[model samples]
Target: MKQNIGRCEFSQFPNLSKTICQEDDISNYVQHLNDLSSDFETRFEDVLTMVIPQLIINPYGDIEETDVILQAELIGISTN
Candidate 1:
């Protein structure tokens, strides 16, 4: 199985003062949020594809191994 983790960072302007600051730009902020959500979805799909197969093998020979594969298949449908 392959393990890959990615991190993203963004600057936040949480301390904007009304007297010294301008009003927030709604259009730009919405675009940024959409972009971030898309990036996260892409990264999650990549990791899920790698991890699900290894989890199905059940090296310890547990009976619940079958259930894991079923659940992974269901998750794959939604992710794809």
Candidate 2:
């Protein structure tokens, strides 16, 4: 997937070290977060594709029909 997005060359970080650690720092952080979000979205799409066959065969795997319950059962995440 990273290769699909092209090679991530080790470029130098921008002049973020000079910025005051406040709201402005958020812009830089948000860029990194966006990259991470994109990566996760790509990976999740792959996983969803792999799981679709099981979902079609299993009665309990209807995430498409019931997102709330399905997410709770499949995602095992802790907001805290």
Candidate 3:
């Protein structure tokens, strides 16, 4: 599993402040799994499923509550 954790800034999305703070809890959970001899890939996949949906997609999609809306993730733009 890749240990390279990327950086993310939540200053622009204050609603995500608590979500960002939850990363520490995720890290500790993963560490606990590791100590139990869990595979890195398994741990990463588990954490990703829990964190990504709850923190990024769900919260951002609730437009009535948050302003930081994520439409899509793309590498480049094109027209056909």
Candidate 4:
């Protein structure tokens, strides 16, 4: 996305003419993405605090033994 945005002219930016911000296209786009990421992090703070299972993120990586309940959840994931 960044590479594609970098290839575009500032004049070609979406809503570039409408936005009141004084920043350049690249800076504005970066700030927009940063804001989106922050919003997602705030929205999913509970999921973040849940300590996502490592194997769910990386199937090939080593993982410590988890409780039976979590292991059941992992099995459910693997089955799908």
Best by lDDT: 4
> Where in model 1 is the C-alpha error above 4 Å?
1-24, 48-80
**lDDT by residue for model 3 over 1-59, one digit each (tens)?**
21322233445556754465456765775577566555656668766566454435553
Best by TM-score: 4
TM-score of every model versus the real structure = 0.31, 0.34, 0.22, 0.39
Deviation from native of the Cα of residue 13 in model 3, angstroms: 27
What's the true lDDT of residue 65 in model 1?
Answer: 47
Model 2 regions lying over 4 Å from their true place: 1-21, 51-80
**What are the candidates' C-alpha RMSDs?**
14.2, 14.0, 17.4, 7.4
Q: Write the per-residue lDDT of candidate 2 for residues 1-80, one digit (tens) a residue.
A: 32312223223434533434454545555667679988988989877667555645764654555556566765443232
lDDT comparison, 1 vs 4, better candidate: 4
Stretches of candidate 3 exceeding 4 Å from the true structure: 1-21, 38-80
If the candidates were sorted by their TM-score against the true structure, best first, what order would they fall in? 4, 2, 1, 3
Check candidate 1 and list the clashing pairs: none
Model 4 lDDT at residue 7: 42
Candidate 3 structure lDDT: 0.46
Looking at candidate 3, the ten consecutive residues that score lowest on lDDT are 71-80
TM-score-better candidate, 1 vs 4: 4
